[model samples]
Target: MAAKRKSNKKTRKKKKQLIPPAFIVGGIFFVMVLLIILAVINIKVKNLEKDIKLEQSKFNYARQIEKDIKAIFYDLEIDKSFAKHELIKENKKILLKYYLKLNKNEVDTLFYNIGNLLKKEKFKISYFSENELSAENEFIKIVFKVSRFKKSANKTNKEMYLKNKNNNHRLSIIIDDCGNNINLAKKLASIPYPITMSVIPFLKYSKETVKIAKQHNKTVFLHLPMQPKTYPNTDPGKGAIFLNTPKSLIEIIIRKDVEDLGFIEGANNHMGSALTENREKMQQVLNALKKYTDTFIDSHTSTKTVAYNVCKSLKMKCGMNRKFIDNVDDKNYIREKLYEVLSLFEKYNTIIIIGHLKENTIQVLKEELPHLQQKGIKITNIKEVLN
Candidate 1:
C-alpha cells in the first residue's frame, strides 16, 4: 500500500507537468485577438487602395475630357469668323469660350457638331440655352459657348466690301542706303507703310537702322556693295565684293554682311555696274547670297546684270525695281516718278520702286503716303512683290 501511494504521487506530479486548462483557454483567446487585429488592418489597407484607385480614375477621366475636347476642335475647320478662343480657368475645371464672328445659323451648326462629338464619347450633355453647350460627369466637365457675330454698327456690309476691294493695288518700295543716317532712317520707318529698308553693311548706324525698321514691321535688306565700272574713283565703300575676290572669299563676305543685319529678307546691289555684267562673278555672288537669303532684287543698276536669270535657274525669288525714284534727288522729279509708278498699276498688279534716304525723298513720302493710301495704293514689302 505504501508503494502504491508513492507511485500515485509520482503520477499526480506528471499530470501537473502537463498543460493546465486555464492556460489552454488563455492561449486560444490570445490567438483569436491576434487574428482579429490582422483582419482589421487588412480591411483598412484594402479601403485605402480602393480610394486611391477611385481618385486615379477621376484624374484620368478629367484628362480624357481635355483630350476629347481638343479632338473636337481639331476636326472642325476654322475660318475668319471663328475669331477668338478664350479660356477661363476655374478651380479644377475649364470654360472654353469662343467669340465667333459668324452668323446665327453658323453658330447653331457649330454647337450641333460639338454636341454630336460628345454624344459619341458617351458624355451626358445639356444645352443651358441656344448659346451654351456643355457636357458633365461626376469627375469632369467641359463647356462651349456660342454667340452670333456682331458687326460694327457704323458701317454697312456693302461699304466694307467695297473698301476691301479698293485696297488692292500693291506697290513694294525699297528705301536704299538707310544706315547712313539714324534720324533719316527713323523718318523713313515712321511713314506708316511696310517699305523695305536697305541698309549698307558696316555703316555707322547699320544695326540700329535694321532694329528700328524691324520695330516698325518693315522689311529689311542688305544693300550689298559690289565693284562698279568706276571702282577706283567711286568706291562702293566697305564690304564690297570685287571682281578679283575669290568665290570662297565672296561668300564669306556676303555671309558676314547678312549675319550682321540679323534680319534681312533680301539683298540688292549698291553699285555693281561692272560686277553684274560678268556672268561668272555674278554667279559667285548669287551662289553666296543663295546660302543666306534666296531672294535678290536687282537695283537695275546695269541692264546687263544676270542676277535675275541666275536666280531663276537656282529657283530663287527674284525681283527688279522698275525705277529708282530718287536718283536725281529732286522733289519734283521724285513726285513725277511717284505718279509714273502709280500709273504702272494700270498694267501690272505689283511694282517695286527704289529710292534713297534723302531729306527731299522723306519729305515727298510724308506728303504723299497718306494720299496714296487713300487712293488704295498700299505700300507692300519685297516678299509680297516677289510673290
Candidate 2:
C-alpha cells in the first residue's frame, strides 16, 4: 500500500509538468497576435500617406486650373465683344471640367463668378442647369446672351446725325495712339459705333490695327505727329510727317502711312506746337492733304496754329480739338473737360474734343456719354463739326 501511494504522487507531478507546456504554447500565440497587429498598423499608415499625396496633387492641379479659368474670363471681358466664339467655347470647356471636378460648393461659386463676370461684359445670362452626381457633387451648365444695342451709332454727317431717331447723342470719339496696341485697338474697333481710330504711322502693329479697325467698320485716321514743344528732344518716327516737312515729302509720307490701310477719310495732328505755329509749314501740309480729298484736324497744342487759315483757304474740311480730356489724368478733370466740350457744343452747335487711350479717359467716357442726349447735346465727329 505504501508503494501505490508513492506512484500516485509521481503521476500528479507529471500532470503539473504538462500544465507548464500548455502555458508556453499560450505565450507563443500571444506573440504572433502582437506581430499581426503591428503589420496592420504599418499598412494603414502607408495608405494614409498615399491618400495625402494624391489629395495634395489634386489640390495643386485645381489651383492651376482655376488660374487659367480666371485669365480666360479676363480676356473675354477686356477683349472686344467681337471675340472669337470658338476661343470662348474652348475656355468654357476647360472651366466646366475644372469646376465639375471640384466639390459642389466650389463649383457653384465658380459658376456664380462666371455669371458675374459675364454681366460686367454686357452679357445677359439666358439659362443655367446643374446636375447632381453620385459623389455628392453637382456640375453647372451655363448659357449666356450678349445684349444688342439698337441703332448704335455708325458714321454720320451733321444732317444724318440730326435725323437719327435714337435718343443717344452722337459723340464721335476718336481714340489716338492706337497703332502700338493691337488688342486694345481691336477692342476699341469693336464698339459698333463710328468711333474713329487714329493710328501712329510706322508702328509694328499699325497694319494689324488698321485691319482690325476695318473689320469693325470703324474709320481709320493717321495720328500725324508734328513737331511738338514737349518732344523737342525726340523725333516721332521714320520720315516723321512734321508740318515743317516739304509738300512733296509730306505727300509721299502720307501716302506711305496710309499704305493699304484702306481709304483714309481724314487726319488729325498728334502734336504740333512748332508745326502749327508756322504758317508756311501749315501751307505745305495743307497742300499735300489736298491730293486725297480728305479733311484735316489740328490737335491745337498752340492757340496760334495756322490750321484754320489753311483749311479755310483750301476749302477742305477742318476741325480743331476743343478740350484735352486726359491731360490732367484725373476723373474729375476728364469729366470737367467733357462738360466743357458739351458747353462748347451748345455754343458752337458742333465741337471736337481730343482724348488719349488712358483707362481713366475710357471709364469717364463710358459713364458720361450716355446722358448727353437728355441734356439736348449732340456729339458728332470732326467731319460733322467741319461741315
Candidate 3:
C-alpha cells in the first residue's frame, strides 16, 4: 500500500508541472488587451484617411474655382461693364478661402493670376497674409495703388479746357518810333491810354518828346538808332550802336542813350534791320541796358536777328509784334490789319501790334479802340501783357 501511494503522488506532481494556473490566466488577459488596442488603432487610421481625402477634395475645388475666375477675368478685360463681374469674382475668391481654405497649389496659381491681371489693368496689389486661410493655403487680398493715378487724372481733367480757351485772346497795343513828330506824338499820347513813345536819341525834340510823354502819363523809350542794311548813311544819331563800333563802345553808347532819355521805361529798335541781327552788337546793348532796369522790344525787321535770343539770355522782358498795323499807313488797310490783329489776339490770347504815329494809323486807332473795348476785347498795355 505504501508503494502505491508514492506512485500516485509522483503522477500528481507531473500533472502539476505540466499545467501552471498563473501563466494560463496571464496569457488570456494579454490576448484580450492586444485585440482591443488593435481595434482602436484601426479606427484612428481610417479616420485619418477620411480627413486627408476631404482636404484633397477641398483643394481640388479651390483650384477649379480659381481657374474659372481667372478665365472670366481675362475675358472681361478692363471696362466699365466688367466692374461688377470683377467684384463678384473677387468676393468668390474671398469666400473660398474663408470656408474651405484654399490649397497651396491653388493659392500659388491664384497669386500668379492676380499679379498678371493687375499688371494688365495698370494696378498694384497691396494686401497678402500667411494666415488668410484656415488650412495650409490662404487667399490673397489685392488693392490697387490708386493714389498716384488719382492725382494725375484730377489734374488732367482740370486742364482740359486750357487748350480751347488759349486760342482766342487779345492783349495791349504799342506804338514805336514817336520822335519824328512831337505834335503827332502828343496827340497819340493823349488817347486816354498809356501810349509808348520810342524817341530817337539826340534828335532835336527827343528830350521834349519824352518830357511831354511823361507829362501825359505816357511811357517813353529810346528808339536807339542801329545801323540799317540798305543805307550805311542811316544815322542812329549821336552815340549810336554801329556795326563797326567795339562791343564796349556799343555798351557805352547804349548806356548814354538810356541816360539821355531821362529815365525812360523801355526801348525799341529804329532802322536796326542790320544791327539787330548782329549777335555781338546785341550782347553789348543787352549788357548796357542791364543797369537801367528797362525792357526791350525787337521790331523784328530781320528774321536772322539774335535780338530775341539775346533778350532771353539777358533775362529781359521782350515783346514780338504780331503785325505791323501801319506799315504802309493806308487808313482802310490799317483798319483791316487792326481787325485782323484783334482776331489774332482772340485766337492766341495775346498780341503785340507795333504801329507808327502816322496820321492814318492814329485816326483809325481813335475810331476803333473805343469800339473794341465796348465789344469785350480789352486793349491792355504792352507791359501788362509782358507781365
Candidate 4:
C-alpha cells in the first residue's frame, strides 16, 4: 500500500507542473490582446485629433478672410470721396464697377490686395486687363463679377452697356525676317494698322527695310539671328550669335546688329532653336538688347526655351509668340491661321502672332486686316501687348 501511494503522489506532482505552464500561456495571451487594443485606441485618438485640428485651421482661415474684407471696406469708406462703387445687372449676372480717382499704382495695389485675399479664401479667379498702370492717366475703372458656386439665378432681359456689348479683343501681328525683301516690307507697312516688322540684321536690304517701316510709323524689331538646331545644314544667316560665342562677343554682335537695324523697338530670335535653349547665351543676348530695345519677343521655337524666363528674371518687357501665321506659306493656311488668332483672342483677350515675310502672308493680311475693324478687333502694338 505504501509503494502504490508513492507512485500516485509523483503523478500528481507532474500534473501540477503542467497546470502552471498553461496558466503562464494564458497570461501571455491576455497581455498581447490588451496591447493590441491599446494601440488601436491610440490610433483612433490621433486620427480624431488630426481631424479636429484641420477643422480648426479652416475656421481660423475663414475668420481671417472676414477680417480682411472688413478692413478693405473700412478703407474704401475712409476714401469714399475718391472712390465710388456701382452695381449693374446684365444678362442675369451681377457686375460690380469701381471708379476711383487714384493713380495707377494705388489702383493696382488695391486690386492686388483684394484678389490675393479672395484667392487665399479658395475662390476661383478669372482675371483680364485692357492696359497697364499709367500714373499720368486720369481716373481708372475696375469691373468684376463673383460667384460663390457654379450656380446661376433667374435670367432677365437687360440692355447691356455699349462697351460691354462689343468684345474688346486685341491682336498684335509681327512680320519676321523683314529685311530679306524691301518691297515686302513696304507692303507690310502700308497696311495702316500697327503691324510690327522684325527685320533681320546684316541682310542685304536691312537698313532700307527699317527706314520704310519707320516712315510708315510701324514698330521695328531686330530679328536677331542665333544658332539653330540644324547649324551647318541650315544657317541663321549673317551676324548670327552662337552658343559657343563668348559673352563679350555676344554682346558686341547684338549691339552691332541693333545698330545696323536702327529704330527698333524690340528684339526677337530669328531661328534660335539651339541658342534659345541655352540660358547663358540667351541672358547675354537679352542683356545686350536691354541697352537699345525696350522689349523682347521669345519666338519659343523649342520647348526647352529659357528666353522668356531669363527676360522675366531681368525685369525686361517680354512677350511670347502664340502661333506662326505663315509656316505653311499657303494663302489658305495663312487665312486659317489668322482665324485661329481670332479664336485665341476670344479666349485670351490678347494674342501675339508671328509670320515670315512671305507673299502669301502679305496677301492674306491685306485682305483680312480691313475686316478686323468691322469685327471690332483692335490691332494693337507689340509693346502694348507685352506683359
Highest-scoring model, lDDT: 1
lDDT (10s digit) by residue, model 3, range 343-387: 354346667777776788888988988876665556776687663
* lDDT scores of the candidates, listed in order: 0.72, 0.58, 0.61, 0.69
Q: Sorted on TM-score, highest at the top, how do the candidates line up? A: 4, 1, 3, 2
Tell me the TM-score of each prediction against the true structure.
Answer: 0.56, 0.53, 0.54, 0.57
- 3 versus 4: better lDDT goes to: 4
Query: How many clashing pairs does model 3 include?
Result: 7
Alpha carbon deviation, residue 217, candidate 4 (Å): 0.2
67-141 per-residue lDDT for model 4 (tens digits): 554455453332656555564433323334555555322333344335434433445333333222111001112
Model 3's C-alpha root-mean-square deviation from the true structure amounts to: 31.0
lDDT of 4: 0.69
Query: Which residue segments of model 2 deviate by more than 4 Å?
Result: 1-171, 260-262
Tell me, what's the RMSD of every candidate?
Answer: 23.0, 17.8, 31.0, 17.1
* Candidate 4, RMSD to the unseen true structure: 17.1
Residues 222-289, candidate 1, lDDT per residue (tens digit)? 99998865445447888899999999999889988987778788899887766877888888898889
TM-score of 4: 0.57
* Pairs in steric clash, model 1: none
- Candidate 2 Cα deviation (angstroms), residue 342: 2.5
The numbered model that scores best in TM-score is 4
